[model samples]
Target chain A: MRIAVDCMGGDHGPSVTLPACQAFLTAHPDVELVLVGTADALAPAAAWPRCTLVTASEVVAMDDPVEVALRRKRDSSMRVAITQVKPDATGLTRADACVSAGNTGALMAVARYILKTFDGIDRPAIAAMLPNSTGGFTKVLDLGANVDCSAEHLLQFAIMGSALVAALDGKNAPTVGLLNIGEEDIKGSEVIKRAGELLRQAGAAGLINFQGNVEGNDIFKGTTDLVVCDGFVGNVALKTAEGLASMISGFIKAEFTRNAWTRIVALVALPVLNRFKGRVDYRRYGGATLLGLRGLVFKAHGSSDAFAFQNALQRAYDAARNRMLDQVRDRVVSALQAMPAAPDTARQAA
Target chain B: MRIAVDCMGGDHGPSVTLPACQAFLTAHPDVELVLVGTADALAPAAAWPRCTLVTASEVVAMDDPVEVALRRKRDSSMRVAITQVKPDATGLTRADACVSAGNTGALMAVARYILKTFDGIDRPAIAAMLPNSTGGFTKVLDLGANVDCSAEHLLQFAIMGSALVAALDGKNAPTVGLLNIGEEDIKGSEVIKRAGELLRQAGAAGLINFQGNVEGNDIFKGTTDLVVCDGFVGNVALKTAEGLASMISGFIKAEFTRNAWTRIVALVALPVLNRFKGRVDYRRYGGATLLGLRGLVFKAHGSSDAFAFQNALQRAYDAARNRMLDQVRDRVVSALQAMPAAPDTARQAA
Candidate 1:
């Protein structure tokens, strides 16, 4: 199996990416790593025979516009990294997965441009796998993809998300929840109300598991396996969770240092603190995937270190090995076809 | 200052409200408490000579609809507590401030009916006070009063929020920020975009200290004194913050009880934990005021205990002392008048 790595991506760039590639190769002797970036920038850090270097001089800045980065910066590391996955004359350039810890917009744009969106998909949704208290990870879709969405788009997201859960967590028809303000049947905006009806009808038809309505506060409550929403709400929810977690940790640290006795206690409980930190750490989960694309592409955090980058590679490897792309495509196609097209007016009247 | 307390509100009702009143009276010598509830309910609790019991027999259930609670339950304690502030024949029942920890929907309805919306104000926004990491608190308006909001309503909320912060926080002109997804020249939906322009124009005209923009994650960052948004986003952000805080506290408790060493450390760190809890607890800060009304009305959490209920009364007393209602009315009326009249050309442009 082969994976393309963007060595010039993320804050640390090759400093983290090169070491991550070496670490992954050490764990999997048969896996090949194709590092994409300028050769001189990576040569000092990467010293492995199994790793092949592909030079790309251009680099997309963290603040660059998504459209500009995708269309104008064709020679950038992210673009080159994804391009390596495209089938050549003999299909030798085809990679199992592509990993980049760069600007999220750049990564999504590059992926969509190179791999293209799947049939019946207008926009690709970014899905983040969060480890819940229920002993498995829950998939939250459209982390920051399409800001404006329709009920049909949300329904499509639900179908795609369920297939993703099946591919990643081995859950069949995972419970799908439409994120809203309340759990009541009459809650949420007009769009959400329509989405709920569609979800219920689809669920009744056995397309996906549609749990009624999940509120923003219940993201971590483990009520549903897949929480679906438009990009605007999803992005705010994701960022708010991140901010709150950081605030709480900061509060704990300040509390422990306010007094001498507590400081000593903090020293003794360092191991427990580390354990708790590890559980909530996003780096361990690697990166989010831009689902509904024809090929596997992952977006790691911009500030990811070697461990985080390596985790991204590993997650990408797993996605490739599990044939996630094929499963998503097949499930979505079949789900769309199996859907009874607007049950007769008489059935609706009933 | 005399504060009217709904002794029959909240989940614990007089059991919590009465003790809170007594505690406040014990701590604060100057303030007088007026308990509004049935005599039978107050009989079980302590009866102080300084505290006057106003007989209000009806009670609004936590799950009752807002219309029913306001219209049908005329003699409800929540209604009686608020009506005491309305202008009577001789204007004798007017309270300095009135507080209730009962159903929030009912409080909003009753407050609007009795206190009435300020001139040019369409609705009263629920401005919740949140704690910042540095010190004090930040004022956020329209928590969940009106879910679907227009640009004009949000502009009104911003004006009211700014005035409240200036009155309560002692800032001459507290900075007002439009709660948005990002801090770009042009971002967010059409409504937010229009609100941003309105705020900018309003700020330039010296009505408020309107800061450019604030993201959802910036609420706890203490970047601005007043953050304003429509009810939908505001509600989501508020609930998400509360949920995350609760989750973190729960996680910390679970972490400190894993084994013997952690338990020893927890014992040593109990004081620190208490201090941290104090900083995050909103009950100590008192209730959130319903701004843009002619009278001072505050809503406390329905599940509030004695301490929480007492804090609500204190909040009411503070609002009364500062004469926040009058200031809001005067500033809002002046600002609305100063705003450029509705443009026929602008409507055509949209």
Candidate 2:
């Protein structure tokens, strides 16, 4: 399997990605590693016989527009990385994946443009995997895909997220939920209200396990296997979740480090503390996947280090090996094809 | 000082309020507590001589409408307690403060109706005293009052929050920040953008200590004394914070109680943990006050226990004695009088 890694991505970049790639290669001797970026930009320590380098003169800064970067910056690392995955050129096995730890927008755009979307999917969504109290990962989609969304788009996301979770976690027809302000059916705005009805109809028909609305507070409660929402609210919820986790962890560390006695106590609690840390660690899940795409693309956090980068590459490899994209396509096609077309308003009223 | 405690509010109602009042009376020895609710409903609780019972026969449920409860439920505990604040037919202060552990909307309505808005203040925001790493409380306003907001309203909240922080923490000219998606000038929506400009003008002109825009992650950093935003975002942020605190604390307790070895570690960490718990304890700050009102009206959490209720009462008494409302009104009037009205074209441009 050939896994493409963007060497110019993330805060640590080559320093982190290089070591992660080397580590991954050492473990998976059969898997080939392709590092994309200018040789001058990469760390001296990264020069290895097993790792092949694809030179790209430029780098896409985190703030650059994804579409503009893809079109104008022909020699950019991100574009170069995606170019290698243009299914027609590589003859690379369908069992291959592309990973990037760069601007999420760039990664999403490149993936959508290069890999394309599935049969009935309007917009692709990113599903962030978070740990639940049940010791499993819950898939939350559209962390920040399209800022504005419609009911139909949300429904597509739900179906796609459910498929991803099923393919990844082996949870067939995983329970899907629409994230809203409240749990009641009549709780959200017009878009959510319509989406809730659609989900209910779909769930009743057994296409997906649509568990009603889940609120912000209930995200970590492990109530649903898959949660879907538009990018606006989803971004807010995701960032808020990240902020809260950091805040709590910071408070704990600060409190323990304040005095000598508390510091001692902190030391004593290390084993149990590590266990809890491992439970909430995002590194365990690696990176967020832009589902509904025709090819495998994984987006690692921009600030990720070597450990997280390696985990992201591994996740991408797993998705490729598991044929996640193909499975999603098949399931989505079946789901959409099974549904009846829009009925005439007059006839429906009658 | 006389504080009217809503004995028919909250889930526990009299069960929590009565004990809280009794405890406060025993501790203070001088403050008078007035219990507002049906005599039958409140009589079952253990009573204290310093507490006076004012019968309010009607009760408003948690899910009831704010305006309807305020108007139709005239004899409800919230309205009754708030009514005790006004000068009676005899023209004397019946109660110096009003306290309620009830539906937040109802409390806000009754408080606004009875106390009225302070001069130059359009809306009275709900201000929460949150725990900070500084071992003190940072005042946050508009926690969930108005979902849709404007720059002008956010400016008013900032002014009010600044004054409240000064009154509570003795931080004269407290720094106020506008919460946004990011810290950069171009990071937020139009509302936040306009608010940031206005606040910068206000700060530069010496009306407030406006600290510019702050991201969601910075709230717990204790960088600003007062954080202001629209009710919708603030409400979500507040709930998110509460949920996070509960989750972390629950996780800690669960881990510590898991086994005998962990139990020994818990014992070793008990002293430090208790201190940490005390620092983040919501009960200590009591209830949040409805700022920018003409008189003191505070709303305790609906699920608050006796300790929280008592702290709410104490907070109301302190605000009343300090004449916080009057101070806030004076400052707001001064600021408004001093601020130059933007030119007609500027208003249109805005």
Candidate 3:
């Protein structure tokens, strides 16, 4: 398996990406990496086993506009890396999957334009995995893809998310939850209400396991295996959780180091505290996949270190190995067909 | 000052509400409490001085529907408690403020119908106080009142939230942050985009101290004094934060009691950990105010203890004494007039 790495991406470019790729190559002996960035910057990483250095002149900055990244920087490392996954004229594949920790909007823009969205999937959804109370990950979608979504768009997210979970976790009928304010039928906006109806119909038709509406707390509770939401709500929920976890961790550290007496107590409590930190570590969140895309592309945290970035690469390798894209192709087709012809009209009439 | 206590509301009924009210009355020598519920249930609390027992035949169950609570349970403890604030034929008020922990939706429905919305405020907002990094509370409105909101509705929330913060905290200028997926101008939905424009214009006119767009993390970071979001988004964020805090606290407890060695360490660490827990205590959250209403009504957590419920009553008493409703009325009028006339259309044109 060959994974394309956008070396000139994230807060720390080649300095972080190079070491991550090297470690990933060492761990996964059968995997090769296509390191795409400036030649000189990626020189140190060339000595690593099975690493192919692909040169690109431009870099898509973290704060770059989507148009600038997508069109203006045609030779950007992000754009070039995405192109490596695109089938050539002779139909030969250079890389199985792509990885980037760059600007979310730019990465999405470049990937969508280059790989295009999968058939039946109107737009691609960004699905991130989070650790839950059940000691497993729950897949949540459209984290920051499309800010505004319609009922039909939510149905598409449900389909894509269920497929990803099923492919990766081997759950034939993964439970899909609609992220709403409440579990009651009358809760949420008109779009969510209509989406719930469509999801229910799809569940009855055996397209996806639609768990009724769930709230923000449900994501961490693992009430469902896959949670579906529009980008706006999902992004806020995801970032809010991150912020809170970071803040609490800081509080814990500050408490343990308050004074000499507390510092002695901290020495005894560090091990247990470290274990608790590991349990909720965001690094273990791995990568957020651009689900519903024609090709597999994973986005790591821009500030990720070597170990964190390696974890992201491992996720992409696993997804590629499991043929997640191929499985989603078949799943999306049937799920689209199973959906009600006019759920919006039906909900209104009811 | 007088406060109406819904004795039959919350998970604990009279057990929690009565004790809380008694404590509140004892703490505030000049304040009185009107305990509204069944006469038999209120018999014990009737012995307390300045505790007037107002009997109501109906008790609105926690799981009751909104319509049933609003119409069928007209004389419910929750409804009757709110009516104590309504000036009777003699034009005399029995209670200055009302507090209930019953079904949030039902309470909002009954309160809105009875008290009615303040002029220029299209809908009432639920404002809950959250503990920020600065050790001060940041008020966020529209917790779960209106699921679907227009751009104008968000602006109304901003105005109401700003007034509440100023009235309670005595801050002449409270910085308000508009919650979005990201801080960028290109992020969020059409409603949020237009709302941003209006908030900006209101800021220019000195109606509010708008700090532009902020993501969910900013809520905890104390980046702004107050955060304004629609009920749906605000409800989800609030619950998600609560859930995460509870889960983290549980994890800490579990880690400390894992083994004999850890348990021994826990004894030494207990003092510091307890202080940290108190810092993030949800009991400090107090009551969620039904903002933009003619009368002051606060909804305590359904599962609150005596101390928690008492804190909620304190908040209600403080609001009444400060004339929060009157302050909001004048503020809302000026704020609405200060807003740009055609922001929604202007956003679309842009």
Candidate 4:
């Protein structure tokens, strides 16, 4: 399997991605790396075996506007890396999947423009894993892809998310939960209510395992295998969790390092504290996948270090090996086929 | 000042509220308490000094629907407690404010029915204080009141939230942030974009200290004194934080109690751990204030204990003493006066 890497993306650019790629290659001897960047950026990786360098003239900065990244910097490394995964005239792709840590907006825009969405999927969604108390990760989708989604879009998200989880976690029928303010069916906005009805019908038809509505706390409770919502709500929830975790960590550090007596206590509790830290570490969960696209694409955090970025590459390689793209395509097609005409509005009158 | 208490509410009913009122009265010698509940429930507090017992036959259950709480349970302790804060025929209220630990939906419905919204305010919002890294609380509003809010409603939330922070935190001009998915003005949904324009205009006119847009993580970072969002997003964010915090705490406890060796470390680190816990304790933050109402009302968590309930009472007492209602009314009137006509659509062509 081959994975294309945008070596000149993210905060540290090649400094971070190159080391991550080298480490990833070392771990997975069966995978080849397609390093996309400027010649100067890709020079160090040239000596590495099983690596091919694809040079581009410009680099997409972390803060570049979507228009600039798309129209102006046409030869940027981020665009070239994503392009490698696009099918050629012969219906063959140069790379199985792509990984980048550049501007999220630009990446999603470029990916959708190049690869396009699969049939029965109007827009692609971003899915990420959140660590839960059940000693497993809860898959949440539409993290920030489509801010204003219709009920049909949410249904598509559920279908795509279910397939991704089944592909990666090997759960033949993963339980799906609709993210809402309350557990009741009549709890959310009009769009959410419509989405719930559509999801229930799809679940009844054996398209996906819909487990009713779930509150925000249920996400961390591991109440379901996958939690689906619009990109706006999902993005806010993900960021809120990140904020709380950060605050708690800060508070813990402040308490443990307050004085000499506390410092001694920290020494004795170092092992247990480290163990707790390892459990909640975001890096181990890998990167977010831009699902519903024709080809696989993983987005590493922009500020990710070597270890974190390597995990993202590993995630991309794993998805490719497990044929996640095929799983998504098949699942979406089957689910859409089983769905009623105008699912969002058909049951509204009832 | 006299504050009404709903004794026959929450999980423990009188077992929690009775003890909480006793403790509150002891702390505030000048303040009187109107304990509202069934006669049997109020018997224990009958002989208590500076306390009056108001009997109500019914109690609103935690799972009661809004319709049931509104139409069926008219003489409920929750209703009676809120009624105490409502003005009489001569425009004089029996109690300065009211506090209840009942069903949120029921409480909001009953409260709105008994005490209508203030002028220029379409709906009442639930506002809560979250402890931030700066050792201060970030006041967030509309925690599940109105799920579908227009840009004007968001603008109202900003005005009300700013007044709340000013009254409670003693900041004359508390900074307000529109809770959004991104910091950029071009991001978020149509409602958010229009809300941004209204907020900017309000900020320039000195109606509010609007600080542009803030992401979810900014709440804990204490980037602004107040963060305003629609009820749906706010509720989800609050609950998501709760979920993540609970998971982190569970992970910590599990790690420390893994074995006898680790247990000893927990023993030594107990002080530091407790200190950290105290900082993030929701109980210390008190209850959520129902803003944009004709009277003062606070909603404690349904599962609150004696300590938590007492904190809620203290919050009610503080708000009443500081005249938070008057501040909110004045701010809203001024903001609406300064806002452009059809603020949501006036500047769309611009």
Q: What tens digits encode model 3's per-residue C-alpha lDDT throughout A188-305?
A: 8878888899899888888989989998888888889999988888888888788788778877788888999999999988999998888898887757999888788999998888
Q: DockQ each candidate and list the results.
A: 0.35, 0.23, 0.50, 0.55
Which candidate's lDDT is highest?
4
How many residue-pair clashes does candidate 2 contain?
Answer: 1
- Across residues B1-350, which tens digit of lDDT does each residue of candidate 3 receive? 99998999999999998888888888899998899999888999867999889999999999998889988988999999999887787867889999998988888889888988776777787898887776677788778777777788888888889999988999878999999977876568887888898888888888989999998888887788899988888888887787778778777888999999999989989999998998888887758999888888999999989988998999999999999877898898786566543222211000
Give the per-residue lDDT digits (tens) of candidate 2, residues A166-257: 78888887998887655667555566688899888888878889999876655666679988876655665566566667756767778789
> Model 4 over residues A162-221: C-alpha lDDT tens digits?
999999999999999999988889888888899999999999899999999998999999
Decreasing DockQ order of the candidates: 4, 3, 1, 2
Looking at model 2, residue B347 earns an lDDT score of 12
- Candidate 1 chain B, run of 10 with poorest lDDT: B341-350
Which pairs clash (backbone N, Cα, C closer than 3 Å) in model 1?
A: none
Off by over 4 Å in 2: A41-50, A63-72, A89-95, A109-123, A145-153, A185-208, A230-232, A254-264, A292-294, A330-350, B44-49, B65-68, B86-93, B110-124, B194-207, B331-350
Instruction: Give fnat (model 1).
Output: 0.37
Each candidate's clash count: 0, 1, 0, 0
Candidate 3 has which clashing residue pairs, if any? none
Q: TM-score of model 1 relative to the true fold?
A: 0.92
Tens digits of per-residue lDDT for model 4, B23-73: 899999999999999999899888999988999999999988888889999
Model 4 misplacement above 4 A: A340-350, B340-350
Which residue pairs in candidate 2 collide? B37-B56
Q: What is the DockQ of candidate 3?
A: 0.50
Better of 1 and 3 by lDDT: 3
